[model samples]
Target chain A: MIEQYLLHLFIIACVYAILAMSLNLAVGFTGLLNLGHVAFYAIGAYTSALLAVGLGVPFWGGMLAGGCMAALFGYLLSFPTVRLKGDYLVLGTLGFTIIVEAVLKNWASLTRGPLGIAGIPKPRLLGLSLSPLPAYALLALAAALLTYWLLSLVVASPFGRTLKAIRDDEVAAGALGKDTFRAKAKALALSAFLAGVAGALYAHYITFIDPSSFSITETILIFSMVLVGGTASLLGSVAGAALLVLLPEPLRFLPIPSDIVGGMRQAIYALLLVLVILKRPQGLLGEDTLRDAWARARRRRKGA
Target chain B: MDILPQLIMNGLIAGSVYALMAAGFSLMYGLQRFMNVAHGATYLVGAFAAYACARLAGMPLALSFAIAVLVATGLGVAINQLVYVPLQRQKEKDRALLLASFGVFLLVEAIILMVFGADVKSFGLPVRKGMDVLGAVVTPVQLVIILAAPLVFLGLWLFLYRTRTGTALRAAADNEAIARTMGVNVRAMTTLTTALGSALAGVAGILVALEQNLEHSMGLPAVLKGLTAAIIGGIGNVPAAILGGYLLGLAENLGIWYLPSGYKDAIAFVILILFLLVRPQGFFGTRRREEAGG
Candidate 1:
């Protein structure tokens, strides 16, 4: 039983790691400040869930479809709101999430409203169903490694460096002849595509898809993991996901009301987030020198 | 036509409450230039505190309201001292402050859930029948809100424009360094401003509770709406905040009549996006910072 639980945790953490890493592309590298990122997650989850559960499509096909759909949505959304900066973008993304949530809740013809879609078929490799604990864990592990390798490559590529440049200073990048809009659009599309694939995997793994499962609060949690791990490092997002996803299960052993227990666990997480931000805003692995330089520049500008 | 009057009356009452809430939210943002997401938590707590005092302790309505305001104000001050002030002093990352505030919001919300549970509570105040005003129904509470909201706005405007303390706050908001150089205790002003702003939110919460049920999740919507109003009217514009609040309230209420009720939140976002695309500085906001700096 203990081993089974650990396997379950491992599977869940791998999925979250995928999510955190994809989010890091937009939030960490691009500095887009998207507060409603879970919309794509929902889109991917619903797309894959409907395909596998309703249309009887296989898991791999559903995953690809889900990712493509999310990317399409991301590209479309980026066109209108690309010019917004900081809080404006935050509000826009938040608005996008709300709209998606409304559609998910009200459009019962497709999503079945709050009843949700369940009993999704797990992935099969070579006509052998890998639905068991050990098999699922292995599958998730492979996905995590693949995602990590791909993300590492992207962040290392010149295109990825362009995203970082835009994040650092869009105006400066523009002055240096880089099309800031094109860079941001590509970053957003890539981030959404990754998040969509993660959602597809999550939907198949959990065998259920519900609107409540992908909420603004869930987005916050995902964002928190990215922040806690510190941005700009593949290792950090995976570590954050593993730590956060697996931390609270043992606390259920304590003799407390389920509600209070959930509340307490969230409180502890919140406290940790507060402490991390207060002490080290750049995150765990962030270079303090760069942060200091930015601070100094802002201060000098203010003084002037 | 009759429905029109009723909608207008309902919109005015709803807008009045929103105006009060946005006034508090905008004042703090103008002074500090940080979105205190935790203010929503304070609003929720204030409503629950009033509910507890009124229903559980059987206190008088006025006394309950006062206690709620005081508690929320104290909590706001405590937050400034414990969380916000420390971070500001350290001069940490801007997003760091936002994340910390989100954490605090989560913490306070969790605590409220633990203490109050998820059940909605009400004060069961004496429900006065609505009076027919030009073929529209207006409850006494709505009337009071309409009258009191503008009075509060007037008071705030007078305080900001006519008083020395108000001038100090405006000066600090406009240029914190210059204000500090001019011997304004910038820290004290920010603290006071935060406390006062949150207390006003507490008042708005109570007023909102008088009309709607008080629940743990109330703060989230209030924060969103208040922030929308502030952003629409320009982040730091006081009078614009009030105007934006009324506009949002009317737009939302009338939108439910014209469009589907499900799109209520969507309407606010559409307006927000429009403002972002067209007039980022807001209706009455000066292009001081954007022009001077950017």
Candidate 2:
């Protein structure tokens, strides 16, 4: 029983790790403060769940479709708002999330409203279904590892360097002949794709998908995970995801009423977020990337 | 009565409250340059304080309102000092401030939920008879909202234009560094801005609670609507925010006349996106070439 609980915890941690890593790519690496990331996650979950349940598509195909759909949305959304600075872009993403939520809740014919879609079948690899806890955990772990590997490769590549450049000083990057707009769009798309995959995995594992799961609160949670882990650090993302996912488990073991447990968990996260941002904006494992970037930009401005 | 006129009246009533919220929000954002997500929590606390005063403490309505405003104003200043001041001192990025404010909002909301439970609370005031104006019926409370909103705007306008502190606030808004050089107490002005802004939010909260019902989650929607208005009118422009609020209210109400009423909330977001894409600086705001380079 203990092993099963630990495995369950591990699976959740892995899923959140994937989410945090993806969000870190846009927010931490590319400097896109996206607040509507959960919209893509919702799209991915709904797409994969609908395709598999509605059209009998297999898990892999459904997940791919979900990722592609979310990527498309990310790319499209980036076009109009790519020129917006800071808080305006954040508001734009926020508006997008609200619109997506509104559509999901109101478009009952398509999404079934708040009733949600249920009974998502687990994935099968080579006719061996991963239904058991251990197998599911392994699959989640594999997915997380693949995400980490691919993301690391992207970060190591010239494309990743360009993204960082754009993040640090868009004007300077542009002066150096880099297409900052295209780079930002690509980063957003990649981030959305990964978030979609995580969403798909979560849907299949839980065998349920709902609008409530993709609320702004979920986006904020993923964001906080990235911050806690340390921006621009892959290991930091993993550590943050693990710590946060495990942090609330002790609450469950406590004798407190279940009703207030959720609120307390949220309160804890809020406190942690405020303390971290105020005292250590670089995050626990972060290397002062954002501050360094800002300082560099200011220095460049002074020089010019 | 024609449904159109009634809807317009209803829209105006709602718009007034939204305008009040947007004015305060815009003032803070214009000067501080950070999106204070905790502003919504101030609204929630205001209503809760009013509820506590009138219902739990059995205070009179006027006294309760005064107490609620004071509570909200104090909370706003406290949040500024506790959460934002330290971050500003650290020279944290705008995104960090934004995220921290989000955290503050969540923390406040969680505390409210723990203390008040998830149940909806009403002001528990006696219902008044509906009065007709130009064939549209409105309750006395709503009429107060409609009448009071313009007065609030006038008051704000006068305060900003006629008062010494208001000039300091505006100077700070224009350029904080220059204002400081000019001997404006930037800290005091900011505190005053927060106090006034939060007081407006408190007024809006009480009015909204009296008109509808109070729930912990109402903050998000209130903030979102006020934000939409602020963005539409221009982020930092006070008068424009008021106009934007009315426009949003009218658009939502009129649009719902044709579409499903459930889509009313979505209208603000759609407008926000449209404004961001087509004309981000908004009607009253001048376009900055530097900002456009991003």
Q: List DockQ for all candidates.
A: 0.43, 0.68
State the C-alpha lDDT per candidate: 0.82, 0.88
Model 2 lDDT tens row, B1-294? 479889999889889988888898999987778778888999999989999899999998999999999999999999998988888766546878888889999998888887887888887668988988888899998999999889989999999999998898999998999999999999888988989899999989988988888888898888889988988888788999899888888888888998778788888888888898887777688776554323
Candidate 2 chain B has its poorest 10 consecutive residues by lDDT at B285-294
Q: Per-residue alpha-carbon lDDT of model 2 for A1-304, expressed as tens digits?
A: 9999999999999999999999999988898888878999899999999999998999999999999999999999898767787878888898889889988988999999989999998999999999899999999999999999999999989999999998888889999999889999999999999988988999999999888999888888888999988888888899889988998789998897765787888888888888889877888889577678899999999999
| Residue ranges of candidate 1 with Cα displaced over 4 Å | A287-304, B89-92, B126-129, B288-294
- Candidate 2's C-alpha runs over 4 A off are A289-304, B291-293
Compared with the true structure, model 1 gives a TM-score of 0.93
- TM-scores vs. true structure, each candidate: 0.93, 0.95
Model 2 clash pairs are: none
| Candidate 2: true contacts recovered, fraction | 0.72
Task: Give lDDT: candidate 2, residue B168.
Answer: 88
Top model by lDDT, which number? Answer: 2
Task: Give every collision pair in model 1.
Answer: none
Q: Pick the candidate with the highest TM-score.
A: 2
